[model samples]
Target: MPTITGFDYRRVPVAEDVSLNVAVGGSGSPIVLLHGFPQTHLMWRHVAADLTADHTVIVPDLRGYGDSDKPSGGYAKRVMAADTVALARALGHERFALAGHDRGALVAFRAGLDHPAAITHLACLDVLPTLDMWDVMRGTTAAVGFHLYLMAQPPGLPERLIAGAPDAFFGHFLDLWANDPSAIPPDVRVAYLDACRNAIPSIVADYRASAGIDADHDQADRDAGNRLRMPVTVLQQDWGAALGYDAVALWRAWASDLKHETVTCGHFMAEEAPADIVKSLRALLSR
Candidate 1:
C-alpha cells in the first residue's frame, strides 16, 4: 500500500519485542490517531490530513494490525495502550491528544484511564467501554457482535475460519458497516483486505484478548471507581436506545468532562464523515 501524502512512515519500537508502524505529519500540538480492527492507519487519512494544518498528527496501526509486527500475544488493551503512549513518547511527546475508532477507541479508553497525565484529550468513536459493551450484548442484540463471539472462542477455530477466506470475512464488515462504501476508496479497501488477510492469526488473537484480558482490565478499573480525568468525547451510534438503556448515562459514569453525541454514519465514521469527525476532534482538542 502507498503511504499517505505529506506523511512520513516508520517503525518505532514501543516495547522490547514490539515495533509499531507509525505515520507522522503536521505541526503544533501533537495528536495521535489510532485505527480500529479490520483496518489500518489508512482509515485516518482524511481526518489526519485535515488536522495536519494545525496539529502534529501521528497515525499508527495498533499492534496487531497493518504493517506493524504482529506478535502472537499481548493483545490486551492495557498493553496496546502502553504501546500508544510509548509511541507518543518515542516521538518526543510527553503529553498529546488521542483519538481512536472501534478497537483503537478501546485502547484509547485504557490509555486515558491508565495514563491520565499523558493523554490531554480523548475521543472514542463508535464503541462503548469494554465492560459496558459486553453488558449491552444480549439475546438477539448480540447477533450484531457475532465476530466477537467467533474470535473469543479458543484460538484455533476463529483463526482457521478467518484464514480460510480472509478477504471475504474482513471485507464483509467493510461493506456492511459503512454508510456509503464509496467513502473508502477502492485502493484503500483493497489495502485493508490485503493487510487483514496476511495477519489473520494475530488479528484473531487481538480480538480474543479483548474478550478475555481486556474485559478483566476494564472490570478492575471499574471496581476501583476509576474514571477518565481528561476531556472525553464519545461519538457513537445510539446503541443505548437499541439495547434498551441510556447511552449517555453509561458514558457519564466513566467520564467527568464528557461530550457525548450520537452521529449518523457507518461504523467507519472517520472516513464516512471526515468533516464532522475533524470538527469533533478539534472541539475535543480545544477542551
Candidate 2:
C-alpha cells in the first residue's frame, strides 16, 4: 500500500533470526499496535493517524507476516509477545499501552501475562482467548472457524493448499469479514492479497504453531492461575453470545481490571469502525 504518510518505517530486530516491520509515529504515551493475519501494519493506517494527536503509535507486522522476516518456526504467541515487548523497548518505551486485533490480540494477551510490568494497558479486538476460542467454536459455530482448523493442520498440506490459491484464500476473509466492503480500499485489498500470497508458507506456519505451542502456553497460564494485572479492554463482535458462551465472563477470568463491550462491525473493526475503536482505545489508555 501507499506509505504511511506521517510515520517512519523501520525493521526492529527482536531475535537472532527475527525482525519486525514496524511503523512509528505520534507523540505522548506509546501504544504498540499489532496487526492480524492477511494484513500488515498498514491495517492500522487510519487508527494510527487519528491517535497521533495524543499517543505515539507503533504499528508492527508481527513476525511471519507482512514485510517482517518469516523464519521457519517461532510463531507461537509467547514468542510473538516477546517480539512485541522487545520492539517497544527497542523504540525506547519501557511501559506503554497495547492493542491488537485478531491474531495480534493473542500476542497482546500473552505479552500482558508474560510481561505485565511492560504493558500499562491492554486492549484486544475481536477474539476470545485461545483456549476459550476453541471451547466456543464447536458444532455449527465451528463452521466459521474452518480456516483455523485448516491452518492448524500438519504443515505440508496447509502450505500447499494456501499457496495454490493464495489470493482467493486470503481475499475470502477480507471480503467476508468486513461489514463494509468499501472499508478496505481497492489498493489496500490488493496489498493484503499480495502480502499474503508472498508469505503463504510462513503465514500457515504461524497458524499451525497456534494449534500446538500457543494452546500449550494458554493452558499453562490457566493452570498456573495467571491473569493480566493491568487495566484491560476488549472490543468484540458478540461472537461469544451468538455461539452460546459468555464472552465477558470468559475474559473476566483473565483480566483483573477489565472492560468488555461489543461494537457493531465485521471482523475488521479497525477499518470498519475506526472511530469507535479509537474512542475505546483512548479510554483504555487513560485508564
Candidate 3:
C-alpha cells in the first residue's frame, strides 16, 4: 500500500470494469482532485495531504490514466466529467469543491459549466479553455505542443507510434515540463512511466477526444453563448504572455466571474510548488 502523510489510498469502482484508484482522507467539506494526462491520482498525493486537515480529500485517477479502467471510449471531457460526478455521488458527496490540473482541468471546466449545481467552486491549474487553447497557437507556439498535432492525427498511427516508445513519448514532456527534474523522485518517475506505458491507446483516445468531440462541445457552448456560472480561478504559466497571447481576456469570454493569473512555475504547478497551489485553491474556495 503506497502511503501519503494523511490519506489511506485504495481503489474504488466508478463504473463497470472502471474502478478508480482513489485516496480518501480527513473530514470536512469534500474536495475532489482530478489529475492531468500522463499522470494519475497519485499526482495529488501532496496536495491531498495538505488539505486533509480540514477537508475530505477525494483524489481519483481519471479514467484510462492510472488504475482506472482504460475504456476504449468516453475520453471526451464531458463524458469524463460525468464519470467523476458519478464517482463523487457514489462516494456520498452531493456537492463539493473541484480542482484539476492539465487535462484534468478541462474536465473540471466541463463539470463546472454543465453541472454548475454540483460544483461549489472550481480551480484549473496550468491550462486554458479547450477552444481558446486551439485558437491561440500557431507556428512555433504550436511546436511546443507538437503532440497535440501528432495525437490529433488518425487513430491507428498515433497509437502504434506512441506504443512503440511509450517511455520516450511520455518522458519527453515529463522531463521538459518539470522545473526541477529531480523533484519527481526516481520511484515516482518509474511509476509514472509504467502507468503511461500501459495506457498509450487510452491516452491517445483522450487526445483524440480533444481534437473532435471535445472541440464540438466547446463550439456548441460558444454558439449557445454559454459561460461558466461559478467563481472560476485559473492559474497558468502565461503561455499567453510568452507566446504573445492574452490569457485573461480569452478566459473572461468563457467565465463571467473569473480570476485568472500567470504563475512562475513549470507545468506541474501542484507537484512543483505545493504551497502555491494550496494558497491558490484556498483563496478560490474562500471566494
Candidate 4:
C-alpha cells in the first residue's frame, strides 16, 4: 500500500481499462464513500479515517473523475451507480453501506433506487433528486442554480467556455457553497481545481445527463410511483429555507422511510463538518 503521509491509498481495477482510486482502512461491514464533482476520492479522507476504527471503508473517485477512467459515455447516475456496484463486488463485498456528496449523492440515489438489493443503507449529502431538484428551483432559486442551465447548454459550448477557466468555474461553487472558506484546505482546493480543469468534458457530460436522461428516469419513477425501500438519510444545507422551497416534503415523496434534516453548514457538508456527517451516518446505520 502506497502511503500518503497519514493515509493509505491504492488504485483498484473496477473494469477493463477502468480503475478507481480507493482508500481502504478499518474493519467491519463495508461502507463505500463517493465524492462529488471536481474532487477525487481524497474528499473522503477525513470521514473515511474517522470511521476506520469501527467500519470497513471504501472511497472511490467516480468513473470520470480523479484517477478513475474517464470514459466517453455512460455518465448518467444509473450507469455511474452500476460502476460503484461492480467496484464493490470486485472488492469482494456483496452488500455495503453507501454515502455520497453532491454529484456523487445523485449516483447514490440511483444506486439505492435501481440496485436496492445491493445497498444496505444510503446517505446523500447536499443534493436532491434530479426531478425534485428541477421542480424546487423556480424564480430566484433558479438563478442560484444557474450552473444547471449553463452546463445543460449545447455540449461543446459549455465545456469550451468552462474549460477556458476551469478553476474559476469550479471555484465559484466552492466559495459560494462553503459557509467557511477555510473549511477546504489549500492543497485540496488545488487538487480539486486541477482535476476539474482536466475533466471538463466528462463533468459537462455528467450534468447534461441530469438535464436529459436523468430527468427522464426521475419522471418515469414518479409516473410509476416508485419509492426507495432501504433506510435513507439526507443531509443538506437549507437551500429550501433560503429559497422558500419545501425540501423535506419533496424528499419524503421519493423515500418512504427517511430521516431528512437541514444542517447549519455549507454545501460541502462532509468537509465542512465531518463530525455531523459521521454522527448522522452512525445514527442512520443503527436504525
Candidate 5:
C-alpha cells in the first residue's frame, strides 16, 4: 500500500548497513527511478505503472527517506549516486537508464557524471545541478530557496526547527511547490508528510551536503572538465527568467548530448504529469 501497485518491494543493501527501500516491477530493460524531497518512492507510482508496461522499473527511497535506512551521515549526492549504482547492480542490472526528481535529480546528475559507464542514459526533472542552483539564486529571488539555506546550516537548528512542526514544515513544500495540489492525492500527501516527520536529521543532512560537499564535488568536476558522456534529457519548470539565469545553457555545460524542455506543471512533475514523465523516460531509454 505504501508502494506502486503490482511492484515487489525489498530492501537492497547498497553499502555497509545502508539499504534502500526499493519497489521494482515490469520487465525488459531496467530503469531506476529516484524520488525527490520530503517524499518517497511513491512519487513514481503513476509513472512506474506506465513504465512497467515496457521497462523493468525500479523505484527506491534514497537511503535517508521513506522506509530506507537512515544513518547519521553520508548524504552527499556523490555518496547517494554511488548508492544508486550499487542498488541497480544489486538488482541484477549492471547498467540502466536513470531518472530522478528534485533532490533525486541532483543525485541522478551526479550519477551520470560520476558513473558514466553504469548509466546508459539520464533524465532529471525540475532541478538544477548544485553549483548552478547556488549560482542562480541571488538577492530576493533567493527567498524561494530559503529552506536550502536553513537546512544547509551547521545542522542542529534546522532539524529542531523542522521537527518542531513536522507537518507544517514539510507540508509547506507539498502545498507551495505544486501548481495543482490535487496532483498528490490526500492519502499520498499523508504518506509524504509522515516520511518527512521521521527523517528530520537525515533530510537536513542531505541538504547540508549540498551546501558543502556536493557543491565542492560539483565544482571539482567542472574544473576537471568532466561531463556526462551519456545522452541526457532534462524536464523542468520555467525557472530561467524568474530566477534570472539560463537553465538550458547551464545544463549544457554538464551534459553534451542534452535535451532540455520546460514543463508548465508544478515542481512535482512526476505526479502532476505522469504521462509526460513516462513519455520522456521512454524516449530517453530509446536514445
Candidate 6:
C-alpha cells in the first residue's frame, strides 16, 4: 500500500463539532487538495507526493467522508467550502492554492466564488458547478448519472438502499468510472470501498445537498455577477461530446481566467492521470 509518506496527520477542528482528518507535508507556499467521491484523501497519494518536493501539501478527507467527523448536517458545498477555509486558516495559511476532484471540485468551485480573496489559485477536476450540472444533465443522457438522482431523493430511501449492499453499489462506480482500473491498486481500492461503506448516510447527505441547497446557492451566485477572480484550471473527460454541451463555455460563465482541457482518461483523473494533473496544477500556479 502506498501511503503519503513524510506527511504528518492530525485532526483539525474547523467548526464547533466538526473536525477534519488532515494530512500535511512539505513546506513552501500552501495548496490544499480535496478528494472526491468514493475515495478519501488517499486519492491524492500520487499527486501530493510529487508536489511535496516544493509546496506545502494539505490533504484532508472532507467532513463526511474518510476519518472526519460526520455530522447530521452541514453537507452543503458552501458550508463544506467554509470548512476548508477554516481548516487552512487553522493550520496558519490565510490564502493558498486550492484544487479538488468530483464532490471536492464542487466545494472548490464554491470556495472560489465564496472566498475569492482566500484562494490564490484554483483547480477543479471532473465536475461542473452545481447549477450547471443540473441544467446540462437533461433527458436520456442524465441516465448516466443515475446515482445523482438516487441520492438526491428525500433521505430515508437513498440511505437505506445504498446501505443494503454498499460494496456492490459503490463498487459499480469504481469498476465503471475508470479508464484504467489498474491505476487503483488492490489495497487502495479496498481503502476507498471501506471508507464509502462506513459513510453512506453522510455521503448521501453530501449528494443530497448538491440537489437542494448546493444548487440553490449556485443559482444565487449565477444571479449575481460573481465569478472566480483567480487563475483557474478545469480538467475533465470529454463529457460534452457525449452529453451535448461545451465544457469550456460552461466553465467560462463561472471563471474569468479559465483553462479547460478535455482529458482522455476517466472521471477519476487525479488517480488515473496524476502526472497530467500535476503538470496542469504547476502550470496554473505559474500563471
Candidate 6 lDDT score at position 284: 97
**lDDT, ranked from best to worst:** 6, 5, 1, 2, 3, 4
For every model in order, what is the number of clashing pairs? 0, 0, 0, 0, 0, 0
lDDT, each prediction: 0.92, 0.90, 0.86, 0.86, 0.93, 0.94
- lDDT of candidate 4 vs native? 0.86
Clashing pairs in 4: none
* Candidate 6 error regions (>4 Å): none
> How far is 20's C-alpha from truth in model 6 (Å)?
0.5
**For candidate 2, what is the total of clashing residue pairs?**
0
Better of 1 and 2 by lDDT: 1
Question: Between the candidate structures 2 and 5, which one is better when assessed by TM-score?
Answer: 5
lDDT tens digits, residue span 109-183, model 4: 999989999999999998989998888788866899888999998768998899888889999988888898887
**Candidate 2 on 89-174: residue-level lDDT in tens?**
99999999899999899999999999999999999999988988887888987999999999998868988888888889999999
Q: Write the per-residue lDDT of candidate 3 for residues 28-105, one digit (tens) a residue.
A: 999999999778777777888899889989998888887788988878999889888888898899999999999999
Higher TM-score: candidate 4 or 6? 6
Q: Write the per-residue lDDT of candidate 5 for residues 1-287, one digit (tens) a residue.
A: 36688999999999997999999999989999999997999999999999888799999999899999999989999999999999999989999999999999999999998899999999999999999999998899999999999999996899889889999999999999999999999999999998989999999999999999999999999999999999999999999989888899999999889999999889999999999988888887888
Off by over 4 Å in 4: 1-7
Task: Provide the global lDDT of candidate 5 against the true structure.
Answer: 0.93
Deviation (Å) of 225 in candidate 1 = 0.5
| Steric clash count of candidate 6 | 0
TM-score of each: 0.98, 0.98, 0.96, 0.95, 0.99, 0.98
Choose the strongest candidate by lDDT.
6
What tens-digit string does per-residue lDDT give for candidate 6 at 67-123? 999999999999999999999999999999999999999999999999999999999
